[model samples]
Target: MSKITSIATAVPVYQQSQMQIYDAVRAVHAGTEEEARVLRFMYKSSGIETRYAAVPDFNLENGRNEILHIDGADINTSGLEDRLKIYDKAALDLSIDVIRKCLHEYMNPSDITHLITVSCTGMQAPGLDLSIVKELKLCPNIYRTSVNFMGCYAAIHGLKHAHYIAEKEPDAKVLVVCVELCTLHFQKDRSIDNITSTVIFGDGAAAVLVENSGSKRAGWELKKFYSEINFEGIDDMAWKISKDGFLMTLTNKVPEILEKKCKDIMDHALQYYGITSEAVDSWCVHPGGKKILEAVERGSSVTREQLQESYAVLKEYGNMSSPTVLFVLEKILRRAEQNGSVKNIVGMAFGPGLTLETFHLANA
Candidate 1:
């Protein structure tokens, strides 16, 4: 069995309130008073208080803007090349920071036998995987894998791979790193889809250390993983590379679709493990948005309190794509440590295929 021994998350230094981002987005996208009003309402009801970004220009308080100028001068003008350049530098820095924190007092960097890098917002050859190797000075022969363009649920794939590696090699130590620079793909457009995506996505990175269960460490033991895709909602959520940064097509229909399918997925996974909903101590649902959380609550046996850590992560960090779910799991792990009790955690995350990924974990 493989167990997650440690997790660490980090966001860029440039922090801004949801309203601050709304004002910048509206300045470029809203053409009329009514449009601005609608945008304001969306931001106010987004259930997000603050979000962090790799770019400082997101904070209008900084006086000058390089990406989203309040004057609408640079709206959609920054090409894909420019956005990726920022992504390359900021993503690597944030990944290194979180990985160092993840390994601190937990494990030695050189001992890691495998590394998995994940992202959806940015991509480049000689990608984050290689950069992490050089920056951390890990073993030159460390096995490496990259999960890219998988949208929000990509981190779970990384974890799944780590679990398999550990199970196959008892002495293996795997490090899974997910870093998303979602804010770099910010689009200045009037469409509801564009505005909604802009309001909810943020930038952050998270790292998890998974190792064989023989180690004498208390952590979450990997049990089982299940996945399903809602083909009908396939068109509702997508990520595409464009000449001008990456584009996101996220519609209002996402929550409704997930609401209808979430319970079936959860029930199926729990039954396979002979576990009941009530037996689970925590539910780490990805906080895609306010409506998504409400949808999960109504669809599954999970209560708002059981999802409190997810809500708290959303309220504090908004959605940082793949790394967001790990942030919630980290909170759950911390809470269990404080209480000095074992926990049964069920985790779920959604993404571009209208994909649903669920996994079970128990105290080791």
Candidate 2:
């Protein structure tokens, strides 16, 4: 079985407290009393205390009743190209840092036979994989793969790709890195969807090293992966490219939709492994938001304690899109090390297309 040996994460330097962001939103949309009231309620209850952003605008004026200005210029007028420029400047640096931490002392750079890059927030040619190879000085001929624009579940696809490669080539050492600059797409619109997306999404990246040798590493083994889609939620969550930046269409019904579908998906995955949901020792679920976690817990019959990693990552980092789940997995692995318990972990993530991705992991 292929083993996930190590995972490391990195975030930009600019950190914003949730209250600061909430205050900024209120100032931007202080239009109607009802709107202000709802915004206050939503931001206050988002279950996030702090998040990191690639841009420092969130720290500009303490988010008072004023617009966001960078060097005395409004950020709302920033265009897509401008955001992409920021992404170009920062994504590679963050990716390199994470890859270094993930593979440092654990594996030799020359031995890395495969590299898989995952992201949904930004895309450009001469993609991140090329830069990673050059910067890390990996084998120039190493096999490379890119999982682009798959949203939060993209990491699962990256893992799946590595799993297949390692299964085919027993000597393979794969690196999976997910970087998302979600904050670069922040919109100035006051629409509920825009506000909700802007408030929850942040910027971060994570890298995982996978090997098929089952070398005595303190990490989880890849067992089985399961996936399903609920077309009913087709319109609930979506990300699309716009002239200004990527636009997110996040509807309020997302939590309810996930609540209904998670049960069937969890049951199917557990049964395929000849186990029940309760048989799993732990759950590393994507905390898309607090409500998403509450929905998954209720629908999947997984207790809140089983989801503390999800909640902790959500509260500390908000949502970093694809990389967020890796943060949870890292936390779970750390907990396992401290307690010395071999756990059967069920890791799952959701994304656009109403996609539900689940994986069964066993202590290796």
Looking at model 2, residue 193 earns an lDDT score of: 81
CA deviation > 4 Å runs, candidate 2: 32-34, 61-75, 216-218
Model 1 agreement with the true structure over 1-364: per-residue lDDT tens digits: 8999889999999999999987666677688899888889989999999999998777767776556644425454477888889899999999999999999997779999999999988888899999999998999999999999998999998999999998889889999999999988877766777788888999999999998888677668998888888898899999998887888998889999988989999998899767898889999899999999999989877899999999999999999999999999999989998995646889999999899888899987
Pairs with backbone N, CA or C atoms under 3 Å apart (clashes), candidate 2: none
Taking all chains together, each candidate's TM-score versus the true structure is 0.97, 0.94
**How does candidate 1 score on lDDT?**
0.89
lDDT of 2 by residue, 143-194 (tens): 9989988898888888888887776777788899999999888777788888
The best candidate by TM-score is 1
